[model samples]
Target chain A: MTAPAYNKPLLDVRGLTIEIETRRGPAVIVDGINLTVGKGETVGVVGESGCGKSLTMLSLVRLLPNKIKVRGGTAVFDGRDLLQMSKSELRQVRGGKIGFVFQDPMTSLNPVMRIGDQLCEPLIYHRDMKKADARKRAIELLKLVGIPGPEQRIDAYPHELSGGMRQRVMIAIGLACDPELLIADEPTTALDVTIQAQIVDLVKELRRKLGMSVVWITHDLALIAGLVDRVAVLYAGTVVEDAPVGELFKRPTHPYTRGLLASIPKLSDERASRLSSIGGTPPEPGRRPKGCPFAPRCGLAEPICHEHVPALLSFAEEPRHRVACFVAQRQMMEAA
Target chain B: MAPANLTAFVDEDPPVSLWRDAWHRLFRNKLAVAGLVIVIFLALVAMFGPWLTPYDFLTQNLEVRNQAPSLAHLFGTDDLGRDVLSRVIYGTRTAFVVAIVVTTVAVAIGVALGAIAGYYGGLLDRTIMWFTDMTMSVPNLLLVVVINASLKTPVTAWMEAQYQATLNPFYRQTVWVDFLLVFGSMALISWPPYARLVRAQVLSIRGRPYVTAARALGLTNRLIIMRYIVPNAVGPLIVSVSAGLGTAMVLESAFSFLGVGVNPPTPSWGNMISDGLRVWQHYPHLLAAPAAVLGLATVAFSFLGDGLNDALNPRGSK
Candidate 1:
């Protein structure tokens, strides 16, 4: 009775299936994906293009395009199913309890509107504050986001601001209501390396300061390596492997995860044969492999691996370290 | 809350209210400004035209009939010996009244219907649009004539019957009846285009992200349409409204020129010119003055509308 056996995860996504009604048929984009983020924990999702990582995050907030529909899922956030929430209810949760930072800062902010008005919009909508109060809060948020001279910048339009400044404004808008969870979808992907690092640091610093859970979705592994506590590796439309940050990097269990790690250039390696790139591009939506999505690129692929789909299997050595591969464990055993 | 001192952080273009910006742009268009000035001047002339004139528009003078323009009569005497200048000035008041009233009502009816149809976008949109199309299908000239003829039949018949009983032919020939006929007919035929224009504009603005953002904020649909949709769509509506004003004025004059517009003795520019054409060999001033004013009014309105379109565009500003 002295201590509780376990703590519930902040965002528990289980068996989430997303299908897009294509010209062909309902093609599954996010197939049977499951993951968790503990309270104040940062979970980084990394995958190549069209691997359903961004779609998976968008699905959580019910922000997917009209064609891509959710088939089956339980995005249990603060004891509520996001998939089942009414449009109005979903809106209340979105930008209120769960903030979203989109990738393209250029298109995200309204071109015609002043930055202050855009920031104040949510406050007036969700908080029911007076216009003056809303504006004051917006100024405070602008200042918090490190926008210079919040007083004058509030009246400026989106076009007047630089790229870095605009992204900062996007983050400020995301953190407007002091949300419990932040879903940042490739927030810094459009920016330069130095600016990307700055944004990553800002997010990490904000998470530490506010004690809010973050699901940072990105294609850049190195960026996530420094910021996130855990890593969820996605392939095609599913999470191939998930483990604590250190364990996933030290011993990547899935072939896709190993391929992703190998692709990254190391400072110690010679320039000639330094990086090992993943062969073949991600599969198109409708034409997916019968067995495993990543089996075509797997070096240890066998007849069984090609014939049967890999289930997310736990290892005896580290139960938390889950990998969806038939031959990864056997290969590890044989090598030892 | 205490009145908080609001300040802009970035020193850029001095912060001005949205309406102020619209006004500035509207005023800057040279043609629109000129048109506005002409309209204002015409409005003043129309208002004070009667007080400035000695003879009434309908007063008949057999002795001074068919006289040339001179300082004594100034604009000369008509067939009834009324001063041409006085009659012309008085007629302007009628044109201004009809143009202003028709344009206002048309914009009001059109904008309301258009906003509702475009924003809702279902059965209401289809029904309103269908009615507009049906209205538009009728030739504008035929529509105006039909409205005028319907109004005239009962009144003309009643007056003719009274004249026959009283043995008096003079009472039926009057200008007041003609002004009423023109005003009512022009208004009826001119409103459909405005309604259709507003609907199209509303449809475009409704698709914008700000409008969607307003909805997501949980603002009531009515408020969202009124506050955001209508305001954003005003840029187009304003241009339409200005252009419609000019079109309606021309339509009113065209109706008059057809003898169904303003009646004889009222001295409306259209009928005045029409009358001058009948006896152009003898009286040229009647045609020249009215034609000049009519042309000037049309040009002014067109210029103003064009100017407004340019001014309201923030990107258009230097």
Candidate 2:
């Protein structure tokens, strides 16, 4: 696909594969996946639980947990390959160029340290800021995240703050260094619905104000409907569809993407009717179908869909929209 | 919606840190407070015992032998006519020294080994854990006794040789040899439990989300261990240490009673109790004084440890 001349991709990950060591042997948890975030773009990575969305983002920073390793991948951020960078160079990119917000705010923070101290840590390490200067900046960050009484709240421990406030603290920390890219992995799954919206709005405002790209990974498609510039729908470790946010909403081509979009409870639905849902769970890692990973669960799967995997191809009508589905590609070809 | 007034909900009282909160909880428990008070009192007595004793513990007064509770001697006199109160007071000093020194050495060794094993895991973890397990498998008393028996002669001989060669007054003091042997043997056996405790603590804290978050922030391994992992792992260690001090005191006393630790005239409680046990039929105060004091110190420490465990882990208490 052709890229806009002015918009250079900030972070481009190609053929990223992650594996988990199991009793049997190493099993592929994240297959060859490709994703990109352009400058100042917000990309929402939507998938079901255990579909490897989080692992893909974590693998970019080499932060996968023990026994779950990045088997192969090349994540290029700002012209340099993150997967091939030296230890020291990778460290510079970690909190300095790319910040990460984990899923659970409650446990992501150091319990013994004060919020102020935790915030000052990245500044002192990455920026070489003096302790006093770091403290001042920490107070400013607290204010930026909409936390009240920045001075007093900074001294409060993680337990003292409410869940919403703690999440705000997490966001403030993620934004502490003014990173070029922020990877937030389900930053609001643990919060109340109201708090979730508040967190989304906070990130949106900060991204617009600071002009930093964001990769938000979440299982909820509806949660990121208005928050992202594009959406990459993952099914069983691979991105089945990637499209502009509005185009994806208008026409989700991949069967799995269609199922996910259909599952979201619409306000216009019948009051007492049950919510629509996909029929089957995503295949297990080692036990994935030989052909398309989603073929077993895809109702529109044909004979060829079970024999060979489909490569991601751009739609003839919209070059920006890409889908990897044999049935969808055949139908589009016939219509054309 | 317009931003809610977030400051209105702020508590009137300033925020108390987790440690301060735990301290407050500890103070509220009457039993723990009593234990703390008793421990402080005993520590003070141990520190000032020399000045507090009216009579020299070594001084022999044949005329006043076997004297029962009197103004001249509060706890009464022993078979040798030495003041029992003075000896027991002096014993307190020995108990404190042995307990403190042995525990400090053990904790240092244990923390270093355990932290390294838990953090680095794989071959190093297996090797360290194997060593810890082997050390723990041996009988505690047998190990201490074997070490004292085998090492004491060589250490004492070396001190004597140093004295002869250099005429250094420091080497002439054979009491140091006894203490050196006792401390080494006791510390050797004392460390395995702490090593295991710290290893388990580190294993759990290593997997915590905060530690992973620290790594994600590009913090060095040393920084993550010192700032994130160790601080979180120290709660259980504190409780273990409190309980350990009491156990060390008892271990020292038991060894002294068996004539293997802090040999005669060093004024350990175990030696005094041994002396008291022999003549208790005629003079029961001799045995009762040191035994009662030892019992009190042990009970006090146990209570304080329990209180600390509950205070540090509030969730566990419920």
Candidate 3:
């Protein structure tokens, strides 16, 4: 695949390192990560749980949990550095230019607030719309999210709705201001499979209609295969491979990414066959291996794999397909 | 399901807000309902006690002095010939006033300080908590007694001076001095619990995902606190206030019985009970009248508070 060159990306994050305070001392959770989402692009951030996928997205908006600090990062959105922006400036950017849909819709929404009020909150605050106008927009937003009888549903509390409906409301709230980018962090994890497909389709349809960039964070690669334009596979708080969706599936160069892709049970697999899975778990935050975080789990590990961390390098043929693995790079070089 | 049928189950009844939901839960609890009814009845009686009382509580009928329960006087007459029933009704008024005033002042101060401390933790939280701890460390009765004893004389003298200088009837009203001392001292002691309750509430609520969602919406801190945090935090506060009202009434009665509460002629239950105690062996009616009513009020408030706590926090119950 030919690389789309010369255009500046919409959001460029470089050397993003996030740390958490522990009893002994501070430990790195996200270690000098680099990522980019282009204009009108839908990028899937696929990772296992605790791979810092959610943390990376949250830190872009300076919404990291207490005692977890962003040690170093430059997240350039539009033209300004998001990390360096003042509080008021950041406020203008959040829910105005950038939207967020959290994982658990059940707890993420305010239970006491009516759906209408929650929908209108951003409109009133960020857009400075009148109450009546915001109410009208809220109903329209409810309709936009395919909620039945939006006029009546607007008055319902969060508890009154089913999980899928609540997630749709959450998405409506995220899209209330017609933001330039939407950061959805596992928005479908808590939902059932069919409902998850519906949400994905809804997001895809909405993105097509609105032309907004989306950073879809999820642990399910198969779920986002047809939805995202590109995929960034995260393993142990670092991006191991990033490529166009088709290319990533065709050539998963990183051992971690390959293992993740292989783990997704395919329809052609024999019913009685054992599902393939990578041995060993991701290292704990404070006790991570010195060289490569994935080396201990990589079947292709050599003596040097434990001595030096592999830097993310682009494939010689396709510049857009980047991979971080010493063995993979050496094999490709030997093959050439 | 089709879109129409999808909402059918949820749409059968009108949507209920959180407050209405809580109210519904409260009404279902029979003990809470009974308590609520009694509290309302007492409050109404207190409001209209003067007009409703058959005889003046203070108007002495010398012929009826030391009488037992009789047809004309329901609760009989006291040693001073005052109607025991009328005095008990007036005592209700005193209890209600002190409870309402002290609790209101305490809640307001507590909510403000607690919200600030909880929202902005660090030196401010430490300082406010330190101050709260210091105030709580002092014995409540001792603090009130000290305040009243030390401040009452000078305040009364100042009121007298002002009455002489300005000839204002308001200044001449010495009962105002008693009320000011009682309210001020009680409010000072009453606030710490409320402050602690609210602080703990705010601390827990601050970490809730909805609050974080609110911040993500670019809402100002003030809006988030008022709209998100405070509304959620207020459920426990309501239960506390319900219980605190009863506690305040008892505290007032105790202080008055000890001669530090509202002075004589106000017909406070505490003072009335104190007076009745002197001749209780001869006339048990005197002691029983005021004591029974006070006990009833305390029990009613406690039941109501317990009901509210259970209703507001349904998850805590089975």
lDDT of 1 at B24: 80
Q: Estimate each model's TM-score.
A: 0.77, 0.96, 0.96
Residues A121-185, model 1: lDDT tens digits: 77887788899999999998887777767888888777777676788888888888888888888
Task: Tell me the lDDT of model 1 at A297.
Answer: 78
- Candidate 1 on B1-318: residue-level lDDT in tens? 101222233455655656676788777666677888997888799889878877777787889886787877777876667677777787687678778888887777777888999988889899988988887777878876776778777888877888889968675675566666666666666778878877887887776645543443445567667777776778767877778877877777777789777766556777777777787777777676677788888888888788777777667646
Clashing pairs in 2: none
Question: What residue pairs are clashing in model 3?
Answer: none
B1-318 per-residue lDDT for model 3 (tens digits): 124555565565778788887899999999999999999999999999989999998899988898998989999998879888999999999999999999999999999889989987899999999999998998999998999889999989998899999999999889877988999999998999989999999999899888887788788889888888888899999999999999999999999999999999888999989998999999999999999999999999999999999899999866
Ranking by DockQ: 2, 3, 1
Candidates, DockQ: 0.17, 0.60, 0.56
Q: Say which docking band candidate 1 falls in.
A: incorrect
Arranged by TM-score with the best first, the candidates are: 3, 2, 1
lDDT comparison, 1 vs 2, better candidate:
2
lDDT of each: 0.78, 0.90, 0.91
DockQ of 1: 0.17
lDDT score, candidate 1, position A147 = 73
Model 1 segments more than 4 A misplaced: A1-6, A61-63, A262-279, A296-300, A329-336, B1-138, B144-237, B256-281, B307-318
Which portions of model 2 show Cα errors greater than 4 Å? A1-7
Output the lDDT of residue B23, model 3. 93
Scanning candidate 1 chain A in windows of ten residues, the lowest lDDT window is A1-10
Ranked by lDDT, the better of candidates 2 and 3 is 3
lDDT of 2 by residue, B1-318 (tens): 216776776775677888998998899888899989989998999999989999999999999999998998999998779999899889999999999999999999998898888998999999999999998888888977888789888888888899999999999998877888889888988898888888888999898878877887888888887898888889999999999999999999999998889999889999998988998999999999999999999999999999999999999996
